[model samples]
Target chain A: MTVATAGEFGLISRVTARLGAASPLVQLGPGDDAALVAAPDGRVVASTDVLVEGRHFRRDWSAARDIGHRAAAANLADIAAMGARPTALLVALCTPASLEIAWAEELADGLAAEAGKVGAVVVGGDTSASPTLTVAVTALGTLEGREPLVRSGARPGDVVAVCGRIGYAAAGYTILSRGFRSPKLLVEAHRRPQVPYAAGPAGALLGATSMIDVSDGLLADLGHVATASGVGIDLRRSAFVVPEQMRDAATALGVDPYGWILAGGDDHALAATFPSSVRLPDEWRIVGEVLPASLFTAGDGVTVDGRRYTGGAPGWDHFR
Target chain B: MTVATAGEFGLISRVTARLGAASPLVQLGPGDDAALVAAPDGRVVASTDVLVEGRHFRRDWSAARDIGHRAAAANLADIAAMGARPTALLVALCTPASLEIAWAEELADGLAAEAGKVGAVVVGGDTSASPTLTVAVTALGTLEGREPLVRSGARPGDVVAVCGRIGYAAAGYTILSRGFRSPKLLVEAHRRPQVPYAAGPAGALLGATSMIDVSDGLLADLGHVATASGVGIDLRRSAFVVPEQMRDAATALGVDPYGWILAGGDDHALAATFPSSVRLPDEWRIVGEVLPASLFTAGDGVTVDGRRYTGGAPGWDHFR
Candidate 1:
């Protein structure tokens, strides 16, 4: 979009018009120094992500609605990764003035739509004219009377499990890279991810030790847990679970399904170290184990027998 | 600055090296799904603002320190405007990968420096590679037992007052626009504004009827109060209590001093309407009264010797 000077209808003004107080948690909305939210509990889990046009997303590849959904999703995923219930989001947008008003409205619509999915609200935001479009979203969540699941809590014998889809966004990227229109399912996943919002809080309830969301590839993100916890991780590849459809899609693209399962990212799946005795939910696929050493390698029959998963996975690296 | 690919030792990794968990509010800093914050009050006052490379600032005109300070100040000012005690800030930054690590470090220093002034901390943030630099900050404030001051409660005959500098930014812009590089004070004022952080909670304590920050010139922002609260506003031109230093600067530029006071934006001073009997702060300048009607006009303002003061105040107009 062409860059225009700040118009009569600027971003901050438009934002004030499009929303109102929609929840009890939001005691105040846009027109204040800060929004007063009913935290109910004393602790708040907050996360922020920056999405720049031509970097995090391409406008040509995604709709304005998708941008809004994805923008909120990115930060919401972070809150979930911390094993916290998603609550409210504050967005800051810098867009070229000449961009269509409809783009922004649709983005707001997408924002509201996605926010409604997790029972969260858009509390406050700021906007201004800029050369390129940029969105910064901050998500706040409540712990609801529980200790936060930190990345440094994993132990030697904990079970490694994952909740929600893995590799869908990466698979979708392959379609985009090949210049082929993704099947409706893959493209939808690429635009707005379906994060297990309940799973984070649930994992905490089920005694999750160290946890993280698969924003970067599973291995890279889990690598963080291992590094932080001072332990090694060993994956059992044979025990890996993939839906029939995702497996079929990987087969059709002539790519190794293991890569998507092992390295693909942005599915926002919840991965955690659970106690060996606990029974994980059917949605959560158990595929690995925590070990004593500080290494990431394959175990008995997985990618293993002897193979080691060295280096980082091919995920969304901001600065490679 | 050259644009580096994802593989370069870009900002995210560099920032990771410079950062530590220095604040108590930040339970989790970087390298986690999201940061865990201690919302001890069970309520949070949140606000967000986006600063672009050109529209909000100029790299050539301001140092990286000033840019960082200004960016954090803008959002923190919003929290202060809300009658909330500033607590922590989450920053999402997009910059050219080749931008000096020292520049990024200085920017971080600037953010921390400003946050320190208000007793706030940088709890969480994300960095990404982008062509042009952009900074978006989401400030979280803790309202320690106070009702938030909003812009929808003004009443007729309420005394309107401003706490802090009004036209200094505009005056500085005039100097910058005229290629005057010798003066340091005007440039410093333009780059780093000293917002009255404590005045907001004080105003709230004094039972302010309505409030807003003077980000968009005094009259223009006050216009929002008139529009939202459905009250007319009239100012006393004779009540101009501007400092003498500003007068000298305006004279040096051969520009009308009232123009800066009226139309210049980005001062971020607090403007509120309170009962006439309220004890005023030293920083506050009594400027006008809330009228009974719904529209704003010159007749509502103060006159000198039976004649209206016709000196023009070019309230900042975004469209213009």
Candidate 2:
């Protein structure tokens, strides 16, 4: 049955029934006016993200479950980017009344599964009927007594490093736009980002200076850190080892893989700056270094091999 | 300039510039990946609400500022209903690209102004482009070491009370629907609800057994409390004091004011059950009494005097 037939409360119950056990941090769950979550560190970290159909995703291209995973990853990664452990999620969904109830149930399942990866739970949400389908998620987390790893901590001489996949989702998007789906790995990455959630707090524990999730491409997001911290970032072009599958996909699409590696977004990878003397873990691949702001002009803080990137547009903007 | 011309980052900077000083509870505010808010009580109370254009509010009926106030009030009231002091709000806006920048700025002003009423601040939010205009707000609050006032705690001997205006917004809505706007007080109430932010914690302190926000009319919401608490609620129709203006409007519209008070929605009044021995403040009007579950059949737990309310539809259902 469609959501319109199921009605608001009925659809809500059907979807919520698919969720697993609540996180221990949740003092109260759904079915109430509000949820109570433990904030043992005396502070709570919160972030919000809205995903609109056709703009952020298309039902024809993604399953309901994949969209749920993508939405949850988009916000949960932000919490991790702040060097916090995600604890609870409050989702607000606005869908057309014609939406299938089973689709919404699978969406909830995807959200629950993704949240489970980081020990978080979907504690509560609101639902409404609209002509457009949109999911707005708010993630709340705890810092565990550590100072938040903000975008303004990168200093001169700090080494820049990244963990997890970087350009796979963009490559997948390119392939999908071309009506080709043979590269299942890239296609799946585009549908559901594999965010490196653990690396955020790990970077903090290891004394990383600053960090951000790669939602708007590496260069574009790094530009944000550079502007916030008043520093310049210079990347070593040779340091990036393009994966075999990505190179293959780029070759099939007749495009340079470097463009995707440098400018692609939605990978949800963690990019961070650390003291040059800090010994990094195996997953943290050093790719660049933070430099003095005097080395670059305003709004052009990121350089490739000591020069401005001649590649395509740096990142995605909601409205261009 | 329109949001498309201003771009996402430009629109964000423009709107955030209109905000006042940050709340003391906020350790970090907007412009970061996430906001860090103080939760001194060791637990955070969170709620989310989504308001869609045309469904929840109309541009011609309510100004952008009023829409913002309404959206923020909806979520903040949910937090208050849980007996918490609101600390921060995270808003997500999905708007068409052609939306005017000035409209968005004024909307932000309204959100901030309403949040200021309860000492809460808009800490951070997300923006996206959509065909529909929607505002989803998530409110975070602190309980101050008190247990949450849930809806499932009422007993047979508790007294049902209400704190704040009931049926004003509904009356205003009816007036607006009929194209008669002379009742300025009721019309403004429809544009923006005057939520009793402080009464929630006071109710909890006075040992309220059960509590809920009246977002779905008195009888409908009381029915929810009765169902959850496994009790029955019997309201005295003679106890209601209808304002002269409302009665006049009802007469002009050829309707019953009692129907508006008992079956109309969106007033955002707080309804709670207190022990019979508790002396309620003047703002809280005792309107009903709680009875044993055996006194009523399933799904018919709330009665007016001694009969089921046959005035009209009891409440709203989003899909139905």
Candidate 3:
């Protein structure tokens, strides 16, 4: 049945039922006007992102479940980047009146599934009718007695490390846009990224000085760290040899795999900087080095093997 | 310059500069992937709402500043409804690429204005290009060691009280739609509501049993409280006796002022229940009585002076 037939209240009731039980941190859940969640560390890390239909995702390219999962992953990755354990998510979904109730239910299922992976809960949200579909998610996380890892602390002489795969999403985008149906894994990675939820806290425990989530490509996100920390990041190309999964898609499209890895957005990997003296954990791959700001050159903010990236676009820019 | 011309990074830099300095609660602010805020109560209250163009507001009817202020007010009202003191807001704005940068700046100004009223800050948010304009805001609040006042606690003997104006927005909406330009205040009220931000916590301090924000009209919101509390609310029509402001609009439009008083939405007033013996604060007006669920009639949900409402629609329903 469509949402109109079910009515707003009925649709909300159905969605609430499918979201399962609330986490212990949630003092009050959806039935209330607002959800109350415990922030035991006396602090809460918060972030939000809005996804619009046709602009953020297309129905033809992504299923409802994929859209929901991706939205949750994107926001959760923000919290994780702050060196906090995600605790809750609040979603605001606006859809056309003709949308199917089942689609909304499936969306809720995907949000719950992705949130559960990080031991978080969908505490509360709002739904409304609109001319197009839009999903806005706010993720809240706890510091758990640790100081937050911000982007402004990547000092020179720090080792740059990453905790998950990058560039798969961009590769999948190329494949889907070009209508190449093979290489199911890359396509799945683009549609629904499985972010490394534990890697953030692990890095914080390992004394990561600064961290960021690779939502807007390795070079672009690291550039933010560079600008904030007043440092330059030099990535080692040898440490980033193209993985076998991306090589198949790259060869099929006749494009450089490096382009995808350097400029891909939406992979949601944790890119962090640690002191050179600290021993890196097994989960982290030392891929680059942090350099002093004086070493940076104009128009070559982030370098790979001491050379500028030859990719067509530096990274994704929504307004561009 | 338009957003496209300014570019995403430049636009973000301009917005950040306009938002001014962060509050002390914000350990980390807008420059990071996420914001870390001190939740001194050891818990955070979170809620979000998405406002779509043409659905939630018309640009022709509202100034950019008014739209931003209303969006922040809508989400902050949710946190207030839970009897929490709002602490921070995260706004997600989606607009066409052609949108002027000045409009975006005005939006930030409005958000900051409303948030500042409650000593809150705009810590972090997202922006993207879309076919139409949309504003999604997530508000976080602190409980400050008090139990949340939910909709399920209104007992039969509780006295229904309201701390802000009702039906003014609906009256203004009617006046605007009818092209009556004489009532400038009412029309302005429709564009930007003045929510009673302090009343939520004040009511809780005064031992409110149940509370809700009047975003969907008094009767409709009361129905939520009634259903959750399993009781019937009998509104005293005499108590409402249309205020002079609404009376002028009703008379100009040739309509009953009672209709707007009972069903007008968007005022964002605080409606709450208190034990009969407690003295009602001067800021709050006594309006009704809660009756046992057994006393409720099959066809009458929320009654006015012991009769079912004969007005057109009880309240707004998104999917209806």
Model 2, residue pairs in steric clash: none
DockQ of 1: 0.60
- Model 2 regions more than 4 Å off: none
Candidate number achieving the greatest lDDT relative to the actual structure: 2
The residue-by-residue lDDT of candidate 3 on B1-320, one tens digit each, is 99999988878898888898568787777879898888998999988877888877888788899988899998898889889999999988888999999999999999899998998889999998888788889999998988898999999999999888788888878887786754777778878889999989888999999999998889889999999989999999998867787787787678998888888888899999999998986889999999987877664357888877888677888778
On a 0 to 100 scale, what is the lDDT of residue A64 in model 3? 87
Model 1: which residue pairs collide? A33-B78, A33-B82, A319-B6, A320-B6, A320-B7, B263-B314, B263-B315, B263-B316
- lDDT tens per residue, model 2, B6-92: 998888899888876678899999988999999998899999999999788889899999998998898899988998889999999
Per-residue CA lDDT of model 1 for B1-320, tens digit only, reads 33254343355566556544367666666667777666777888888887778677888888988988988888888888878888788888888777777778778888888888887888878888777688989888877877778887889879899998888887887788788853676667788887888888888888889888888777777777876777777777668766687788888888887878866778889999998888787778888888775343544333223344456543543323
Summed over model 1, clashes come to 8
lDDT of each: 0.76, 0.92, 0.87
Clashes of each: 8, 0, 0
> Residue pairs in steric clash, candidate 3?
none
Q: Fraction of native contacts in model 2?
A: 0.92
lDDT (10s digit) by residue, model 3, range A1-320? 98989887888899988889568898887877899999998999999988889767878888888988999999999999988899999988888889999999999988888998888989888888887788899999998999988998999999999988788888888898998755888888888987887888888988899999998889999989988888989999778768797897798789999888888898899999999998987778899999998887765368889877777776889888
Chain B TM-score for the candidates in order: 0.89, 0.98, 0.97
Ranked candidates (DockQ, high to low): 2, 3, 1
